[model samples]
Target: MKKYLLIFLSLGVFLNACKKSDDDLTPDKGLTPDSEEVMVQDFMWKAMNFWYYWQADVPNLSDTKFPDTVEGVEAYTAFLASESDPGVFFDDQLLFSEDRFSFYSDDYKELTQAFAGISKSNGLEYGLVKFSDSDDVFGYVRYIIPNSDASTKDIARGELFTGVDGQTLNVSNYIDLLFGDNDTYTLNMADIADNQVTPNDKEVTLTKMEGLVENPVFLSETFEIGGEKIGYLVYNGFTNEFDEELNNVFGDFKSSGVTNLILDLRYNPGGSVNSARLLASMIYGTHTDELFLRQRWNSKIQSELSDSQLTDYFADKTNDGSDINTLNLSKVYIIATNASASASELVLNGLAPYVDVVHIGETTRGKNEFSLTMVDDFEGSYVYNPERENQINPDNQWAIQPLVGRNENADGFSDYTTGLVPDIMLEEDLENLGSWGDLNEPLLARAIQEITGVTGKRGFEVKMPLLEMTNSKMFTILKDNMVLDKKLDINIQ
Candidate 1:
């Protein structure tokens, strides 16, 4: 009787173990947060693993052990359980409404004070902390305290301090404050509303193209050549509209006696890659091997567009006369600055093989890929986060993406981290410019020099440049004029 009881008990334990194993392999429905947690953990693990897989062949984050790295499958499982959720300890009171939150809210404030004290005690620069309302919580966390040790370097974000009591107080910003262009105060914008942040007096001037569609192509002989005409075409922004504009511009440039082309992307914050490709084709006369620009992400967040899968994306583009295999190339001088990014970088990479591309001004902001659109559960709106994208080059390897793929030049040699150094570097003349304009216009002058071989003056000053139409003006005018004058006809007999 004892032997039979033991055998039954053993069988029961075996069955329970088998059921647990089966549960592990089962497909998860969206019924529990476990599924969400698993998805995020899986992505983070894959991201780390991808780094390890490529590290043997690429230049990347050193294989040095991270403080976060864990051992054993169970340990790995436990670590992810803690780290996956960013909103784990969200303060319901401090969310949404601005009035409930304060600079002295919680431990964050005390943490900042402690960090400030440390800075002053060491006689180091008290890193400035600026504060403004922010759309993203994590974004605020990242931009300010990018890492754990960030407080030691700059002013602490919100505040997270050590538990050591009565540590000497370092002088720091009471709250992150926005002050006029001052070196002493690091700008804090974690609290400003999107609309409120936009400067009412801010000026944006557009030239070359005139229409609702933001495709601008302009011609100018303002830049001179030696007894010959050098035409200048400056288009700063890149968009789908710009793509359509490029088709027309390239078609015109081929026919017109336009020997030199200048693309002014100095102030462009970046837009669409389709436009970047279009611009690349116009400059690079032929197709080249894949170019790496940036990374894309596959986040756990649900995007409206995610519902439309990649298979559908390819199919839809086919109907719209887009075949991914083909590209155009033409000779162009792409003007760049530090502000240029993402698709703008794509333009540079795509055109590198075809033209004597000269990147002027400063190094570009190296965001190379489109972000995944994540709908916030609380806000019910879209937010963007970077993603990893694969771009196989002529060497059949990943392109220059920091922390992921290999960084390489067009020659297939990896080293594009500080970004593609300009063929000719020029410093912006801040005294002569109101904003980041074509202060040096080095690319423009170079394009002229390329065609005419004449060295022109260094910087052309524009003191009272035209103020662009404001949103209010545009809106008010539209409201008053129900029918556009161009669209209406007065044909009353």
Candidate 2:
């Protein structure tokens, strides 16, 4: 049965690739070189018209405005070709004022790799915290990858850096010093004294690598407290490739007879929808046939899609055919921050109807919409070839991840534009930092207190009033396609 299933999957992929290749073939129209460019422009417009969630807001994409006739196609294509850059021209048509997730990428290869949890990095994820009443900034290491150069150099989480390559970190040079194009640089460590961070004498040299696979499962453990087995999972990203690892963690939780779950998504930026659905299934347990999420596309496509095709249901197994280790719990605790978005929000929203979700920490990032990547095939069309497993356009090197749908749960509740409010709003205790997976950690501690009905002593207080300041600069590094994601594939093929 498993062998037959594998064959069926392979055949499906083959048929989809063949269909995409046939779709890419353009009609033989005797036209000039400029007209060829116009055809590509038309391709972009049509793709957006059929799939974009905000298609109604885009006046240029309306079928009545740009019909599929020779006159309409010629006029629209000529206008699009007049722009200096077609990519920029495509961006102008999107509803940027309200839709911030839609983005254009010059290289689809890089974007596709990013979706698979692979990227160029020194294996450091940090947040820049600026001291109040001063221009000095400190880089706080969040986590490091296991095989990265930074990990080899003995860089640990919660370690602060005051300078880069001996240059002081100020507002002006912070961006360049941290995000500069240097292959190797020295990090001047900082010392925390009297609730303040200052430059220390220690320095560590680090080198950046080309491809690093980001391990999304940071930590997972089952704890015994008051005869109840509590499972803790610090999941950072929703990358689909890591679904097997995620399921394995859940398998351990099931084996230990976990009664409650604490899902840590404080630093997670969302990824794939398939992984999110699998996770929802693992948590809810009995909701396999229930609606997990519904994607409401633009009016044109919405009318064409059946009810079943537009919605995603909970599944008993992961994408790999392995049985999911479900908890079957009535309540669960989720730790979130402003960084939690997309699939993160999807899990929180989708499970609300069935479970008593006790959301801790800060408000969510408030992105209720999802995006689909559209790449150019260089043959004046957007192809959805399954042969391109990662769905990357190797030819033109151009792609657009546009907001293709707004997601809703079984209750049809999708009004979280601002953000989902936390049940208990407590700031992250960075002043008295505790290691992750430690039950004494502030966020995890509070969750344990709620579970066991026990109030433990709090961490030592520090006199850092300025640490409460919201650092907008911390989120600057995440302003890319990495932040935007989808609930499912919108490709018709």
Candidate 3:
């Protein structure tokens, strides 16, 4: 029940002010709305009108599209009945063509749980890469969640799978084969060579369970190499609930007298803005007085908000008020990939103005626009409020995570839509995706090389470039998002 800065899409909040500033967001709930779809459509339109970042740009979402009266309600009833499915209307009609990350869900319960890192998963977080020159795809294990069905099976990271059940995986059947309605599936293992993939004798069966909570902190260890105490953390997501646990990892890093840190955000897709801020605070010094990030909503919101209300500052403690462990380093080495997005990108961008961020991986997933979580709670201006959950229309379990703002660092730079380019270019080698946290791993090896000026210790060669087609986490809501959180509680104009 974490409260988010009411937004939509995959954008994160840049609310500088987490203060509560209520506005008169009372929308016409459609006095004589046609049907259930009309009701949901009415809610969607109103939410977008007030909070959507491109509301001004989307002609359909224009403030003048409908008057703020009973006639507007009648228009909503009449116009919405033309479309049968709310999801279709949301996608085809309401969303902007340029919008890449905005999304709507039928079930707010599942969506919120996803933001909390809870979902029905086999525990295998994998990425699908197309074979050298064929449409045929091979899946490689990224990481596994503790106590997941995959965790119990005989599977490990860097393992390759060419098929599901008995069918060979390809560009078309993979959706139904892997993420389809079937609860249980067997992964047909494979062996990789010079661009050739061959099926092996091993098969691992995994079943999806209810409410699998994954800890974003995959691994945290300090390495003593070349007279430098370096910390390596493989953080998968920015799940807010696990913020305390993530903070504790830094606490351990702090105690170990680690001067250098290698933040492995190669698998992270993003989570809470607060969590990202906290992580930034941990890496950089917690200067509550200094700015961390800022927000730029639609012009209407921009006009309504004061300068301070649009900016967020670095915090000295967690949301729970525990003192944050700060490294206060001048430079940090970051491990990124195409999967690194949203809040993951935020940490690097936000810290760039302060700390020297050495990005060492593929180009990141470009999702800078921050979104908010909104239910059908119109009285609260479409903002999802935990205290007002019961008040939310029970008939409307639908929720919209819309792009409401662009999150910029203190210097007002959020233009990474194409993606944040890396300082060092390196892609994951599929032929030898070495063990996680091991120094011999390609990404880590490069980071260590940069740290201690040791190059020849670990082989740095790209046997075969991993051309990623898709991934497991990308299918989830975690992919390509920088959604909203408490920062701007400004009084809506």
Candidate 4:
């Protein structure tokens, strides 16, 4: 059955080539020497025309505009030839107002590595902030990946740093100070005196390294409170590479007879959709055949894919083909913020039909769309096979992660463009942030209180620092039109 599906997909691609009407511009075959500069551009147009969710919105992409006629072929050929850089040309063709998640990648290898939770970094995730009513800027550690230099130096989350290499961080140099392409750098610690952040004498040097695999399951533990076993999991991302480890954590929770679950996704900027489905199935053990998420693709590709294939269902197996450890919980407690997006929201929305989801913390990063990593397969380089082994395209490194479909639950409730509002609106306790698994943490404590019927002490009210922008207008413009750092693979094979 899977073999027939692959043949059907290949035939579809061949049919797409027949519509081009130009021998030199055969997209299904490789690109010609004359079209080498704009090969990626041509690929982008054809791929998006077939798969993009907003293909109907883009006039240039419409079949009527670029039909099989002689004039239509000329128009498309001219359009592709005009752009020197295909990445920029592809961006200009997208309906930016509705398509924010689609992106072009110059290096597909790095992007693929990121999907597997492997990347080049110093393993320091931090947030930049400015003091209230002042121009002073600082950054605080969010979390450090284990086995990284930052983790080795004991750089814990919520620890403030005022400068890099003894130079004070300001609005002008903060970005370079934190994210410069340097192998080694010093982070000068800060002292919080009377709510004011100042540079302290302590400093930590960090060395950046390549191929750092991030462990997404940060903390997982089971607690006994009020005679009910409560499980806590601070999951950072939905990387499929860690699916077995995630199931092991759930297996422990199930063994401990956990009745309640607290899922901390405050800083999680989502990942793989298959992992999300596994997580959802682990929570709702009985709904194996129920709809997990329905994908709505463009009209062109919709004709090729069946409704059953497009709709994902709850499965008791991981993406790596391992059996899932089910929890069978009736209710779930999720702590989320604006960073929780993509697959994170999929898990939350998909489980709402069967589970009593108690949401806490700020609103979620409303992203219901998923993207497929599209690489140039015409040259047989970077061609994705079902078996997961493929040759690299060192010459042509262009790839795209386009917003190909929107996600909906079994109830078809996916109107969260503005974001998912929290049932209990409590901001993160920045002033007194505790370790992830500790029950003393404000967000986890609140979830435990809600589960055990005990009132916990509230932390001090701390305002989230805003970006001290030197150019307010530019900042506003960028903020309103920035692509978030959340990607989901729909696995449209």
Leading candidate by lDDT: 3
lDDT tens per residue, model 1, 49-122: 22222333322212232233334334445534654442321222111222111111122222222211111111
Better model by TM-score, 1 or 4? Answer: 4
Poorest stretch of ten by lDDT in candidate 4:
471-480
**Model 2 residue 277 distance off true place after TM-score fit, in angstroms:** 0.9
Per-residue lDDT tens digits for candidate 2, residues 259-312, read 899999987877777788888888988466889887776765566455755688
Compared with the true structure, what per-residue lDDT tens digits does model 4 show for residues 1-493?
Answer: 1232322133333333343454322333322324456667776776676556788888877756655666666766787877678777888865456776677778776666766677677878776677666666887777888888788895788788888888888877876766667779998998664566767788899987888888999988889988879999989888777889999999999888888899988877787777788898888884677887777766765565557566777886765567889988888999987767777887889899889999988787788887666666643222233333254344566777777777788898888988898998877645666677877877788888889887756643545432322211111111211112222222323
lDDT of 1 at 160: 21
Q: For each candidate, how many residue pairs have backbone atoms clashing (under 3 Å)?
A: 38, 0, 23, 0
Q: After superposition, how far is residue 401 of candidate 3 from its true place, in Å?
A: 0.7
RMSD in Å for candidate 3, one decimal?
A: 4.1
* Best first by TM-score, ranked: 3, 4, 2, 1
* TM-scores for every predicted model: 0.42, 0.83, 0.92, 0.84
Q: Per-residue alpha-carbon lDDT of model 3 for 1-493, expressed as tens digits?
A: 2343433311122232234445422333424464565888878877887778888888887767766678876776777776779889889878988899899999988888888889888889999987667788889998888999998899998899999999999999999999899999999999888777889999999999989989989999899998999999999888888889988999999999999999999988998888899999999988999999988878757776667767789889887889999899999999999889999999999999998999999999998988778898755667776667787899889999899888899888999988999999999988888898888888999999999987664567798888888899878755667756654343422
Clashing pairs for model 2 are: none
lDDT of 1 at 382: 14
RMSD of 1: 20.6
Q: Report the backbone clash tally of model 1.
A: 38
Residue 260's lDDT in candidate 1: 59
What local distance difference test score does each model get?
0.33, 0.71, 0.83, 0.70
